[model samples]
Target: MAGAQRLAQTLAGRLDTTFTKVGTPRTPLDADWQAQLASALPELRQLAETLTLRLVEGHKPLAVLPRCAAALATLPVIARHHPDACLIWLDAHGDLNTPASSVSGYLGGMVLTAAAELWDSGLGSGWRLDQVVLADGRELDQAELALITQYDIRHLTSESLTPEALSQAIGNRPVYLHLDCDLLAPGLMPTEYSVAGGPDLAQLYALCSAIGHHELIGLEVAEFEEQPDFAMAEAAEALCDALAPVYERLYR
Candidate 1:
């Protein structure tokens, strides 16, 4: 089982979410896979129609966000209502590497670029790179660093996520939140992609709590790998607790 499913199950048990499982796309990055993603998009669009805070689970951040872009393309309602939606990308790495810039060539590393490119084509009506607040991004690649400087994407460094800062970054815009569990400080748990010197759980949760003041549209949590002895459970619990405010706002 993928860690995402386990995390979703655990979160469903604890939160007010309704669970729906979907197949993960296995095709490579090509036209065929892009077509498949287009077909798969409506599932999320249907969920978005409900106008509730939806929890999306995926094995990798790449698996979710790119597909989400496709889904968003079909959701005119969301676009009409949230034309100014901003993304709060919580990850240790910038996830801004293009295919030409990535050293590791990990598809997950290229997800942000893929999503950005999709939006560039006006696919999802998604937020632009400048609209993203990259919280706890400490493992940025050199290429990502250069691009971030060029684009001036905001990197969130406050010990606690401040509503003013968040508001300043993207004022009065609905938020689409993404959390990569790897963003947690080292040794919190065994994440699939670990980086050093990130925020601990307490600080991370504080950020989530601060997000409650915004109009949150959706959330996706990825990059959590299951561990033995309930360690993964503990980690998921911490995430759920931190996101409690957003969850409550969405659920209500």
Candidate 2:
């Protein structure tokens, strides 16, 4: 059981979502994000299609994904209908690394950069840099930092993640939210990447509540690892307990 599935299923029990397993792509693992995308794009394309169908049919998606690269599907699909919608990316890292800049070459790190046409991901770049808001991004790579300065993308630090502040930043524009659970404090939950100095659960709840007002287009969560101590469902419940208000607002 992967962490994503466990977290998603647990979240489903609490939120207004139906749990469906979107299976993984089976291909020889490539060295970096770009090579991986190139190798498994065919299967990933099918995965995107499924998400697209559900979205067009009026489903508010709660996409639980292992890698942020899965946002390759979510971002483009949501942008198709709501081009003007602001994508509020809630994560610890910038995830803005381009192929030329990424030192680690992690696929998740390059997802949004690809969506912004910084690189091609075969799914088409439907999102623009200006239409994105990066919140709670504290642990940024030097390459990501340069890109931010170069593009002047909107980013909010942890202190500025208040609902009032977000509402002011995103007035009258509907929003698509992506959560990488590592945005929470390292000891708070299990995630692939654990950077120090993340927000606590209370702050996460407040951020979600604030975004609820922006008319959530859809939401996707990544980076949540399966916990060994608590049951997966229990961990999900504890971690997402604060986000209930956001779910109620969106699902209601």
Candidate 3:
């Protein structure tokens, strides 16, 4: 959370616009978690419409992402202005495993499926699996691989996250960028979920530049720990530097 807050501050200093903090729900996720998020939707939506750039910082529990996605969908800008806004999910894991197919039963692993809710009972949100573009996920589980094949969701491999390919994936829709810190290469980012063989720092900056120049409605950087190691600190600094251009592009 401190990392995110610091990033927000950094952006505030560099960019022409101020970074407004859109508060996340404090309630612990339980059976009524969806309802809790829904009740908070109006306020979130208002902020989305009002603020130039809203940076949402959180622990980013996968179980709560579906609810978060629900609230984001209701953002008056997305719901009213850009109805065709799609999600760009940058992560190391596929996050497509369902409870039945999951081997580890980790809630974070099922985030994309939960957000899309294409199979299970949905959070009554607008996102569908078809509207998501998954990038840089090399740590996919067997079940996730099977599900992606069955659903035909666009999975952009590490080799495929190039500028031309990303442009094609995004097409004409505005984007909601969801960046998991673990998307960085294992040694680059010291998050709990870091995986090897992901994009390096140069590729990461290029990736950010590619999609960020497009129509971006919102940005969320998640899974940052309250306490970071030396490697994590370095990684976070690099991320902020890369995104400085993205922040500039938002106004352009």
Candidate 4:
């Protein structure tokens, strides 16, 4: 979450606007994942209401969240506000596991599934599977693969990313882009959980540029961690540079 704060501060300074933090945990939770989620429901609901108000006020959203599990809050707001919107999910894992199928019992890995109503989150409604697009998922569990094949979910590899292919993936619906920082190749950025191979910063820049051409509703960034040696504010500037096109389009 340090990385997200640095990024938000940098962007807010550049844009001459202030960022609002909905709430922060006073201390670490000494409990299991489900209990942690239960404790966090109030704050998550606050975030959902904030986004809903922005969309209702006709402002496009660009959220920098500490973790992807927070999507269990944000995704529903986006999906409900724009029923025809398609989420272009760019992540390192499928995040498609149900409570029963998840081996690690990590809530972040099942957020999208929660967003899809595969489980009742008590936050809000779920997204339509047909309006979803998964991209750059290099590490998928066997269960996730089965879910993909069973649902016929659209999955795009990094090698095939291009303007045409991206547009094809998004179809004619308006776009909501979710990016997990781990989606980048390791060593290029600092993230809590990164695997071996994925797209580089240049590819990320290109992807943002191409998606800028679409009717974009929002951008959600998650899982960026802090590295003491790597300057946080400097990394934030680089990220903002790569995201320049989409930010320009959204705030234009």
Candidate 5:
């Protein structure tokens, strides 16, 4: 929780935006737990009143998925009021699954599905699946893979994405890029819970450039743990550097 707060502070400071931090206790993926999560909706809505700068509580990987979906559901409405908006998802997993089909039963893995409306009963309803761009997911389950294949969503895997490919994939969309620190190589970003291979620094920079040059509504970097070998502060700084140019152009 502290680490996420720090990251949010760092990101807001670098981007010259305000940041709001919220917290959620770890909960299981049961009916009671979902109710516990649903209770936070009011606070989430208030925090999202204006996107200038805000950070809500996110913990427990599984719970984070539902929370993210719920939050994202509000975005399209926000976008309707303020049109130009798109979503860029950065992670190691696709987060696409229905509750029944989730083998691991990890709710975080089902976040994208909620956003995509693949999940049966979570996340109120928001943008269409076409609005999201899954960036740098290298690990995916068979079920998740099938969903991606069926939807034909635009995604760039960590192994296959070059800076060039990332640039092309994003094209020119007004974007809300979500960076799950796990999308970095294990050595580079050890704070992440799961580290399957991810994009290198160079590719990441290129992708950020594309994102910044295009219309970016906002950005969210999640799932950064504080580990002995990991320098969360340094990683945050590097991310700020990568995004500096984008802000420069946007503000210029």
Candidate 6:
């Protein structure tokens, strides 16, 4: 929660935008796989509120989809509220796991599929798959690869996305960017769950700047563990600074 608050503060300070901090409840359901999710319901819903507060009011006390689903739910409101918005999903894994298929037992890994509705869930029923663009994704399982191929979702693999390629792919869509810090190479950003070998800092900044040239609704940086590392925080602050101007152009 402190991490999220810090991120919000960083964005508000860098972009000169309004930031609202909401509190979430702690659920004590269980430590096992599915039940652990229920425990996070209150906090997740609070996050959902934070994501969508610009568009609507009222707290819906439900277990929202972990990360991807949360993003999916927020997108429609962003699109409706700011119709020109597009989505850039930056992660190491495709995050397209269903309950039956997921071997890791991690709910965060399943977020993308839930948002895509490739997985069965009542929580993320609101997102349309067409609005999303996958960028810098790697380490996809076979089934997840098939799903991405089946959907024909536009994705640029970490190896393939030169700065030029990334800029062209974004192609002037008003973007809502979701950055899971794991997309960076492991040593550079050790706080994330992504595999080794990804774009370097230069490429990342270029991509963010390119996408920022378009209208940007909101941005979310997820999957940072609470351990404080000056290097990690500095990287995050730089990324936010690069993205701030684009955010300013859109919201301010």
lDDT of 5: 0.59
User: Compared with the true structure, what per-residue lDDT tens digits does model 6 show for residues 1-252?
Assistant: 455555566666764655665555244344654675665556555655565664465321111122443453454445556555466788887777778788876677776666656665444443455556778778888877777777777778876776577667767776667777678777655354758787766667777767757655556666554456546566557656655545555555
Q: For model 3, what is the alpha-carbon lDDT of residue 33?
A: 32
Q: What is each predicted model's overall lDDT from 0 to 1?
A: 0.61, 0.80, 0.61, 0.84, 0.59, 0.61
lDDT of 3 by residue, 4-26 (tens): 55556655555544554555535
Candidate 5 Cα errors over 4 Å, as ranges: 15-18, 23-36, 39-42, 50-85, 120-123, 247-252
Number of the top-ranking candidate, with lDDT as the measure: 4
Q: Estimate each model's TM-score.
A: 0.73, 0.92, 0.72, 0.95, 0.76, 0.79
Cα distance off (Å), candidate 3, residue 81 = 6.1
Q: How would you encode candidate 2's per-residue C-alpha lDDT over 33-119 as one tens digit per residue?
A: 657777767766876888888888888777788777778867888888888998888899999988788888788888888898888
**Candidate 5 lDDT, 201-244, residue by residue in tens:** 66677777766667655555566555666676897677667656
- Which pairs clash in model 5? 18-53, 20-54, 20-55, 22-57, 23-57, 62-107, 62-108, 95-109
What ranges in model 1 sit over 4 Å off? 24-81, 118-125, 158-164
Which candidate model has the greater lDDT, 3 or 4?
A: 4
Better of 1 and 4 by TM-score: 4
What is every candidate's alpha-carbon RMSD to the true fold? 6.0, 2.1, 6.1, 1.4, 5.5, 4.5
Show the colliding residue pairs in model 4: none
Output the TM-score of candidate 2.
0.92
Give the candidate number with the greatest TM-score: 4
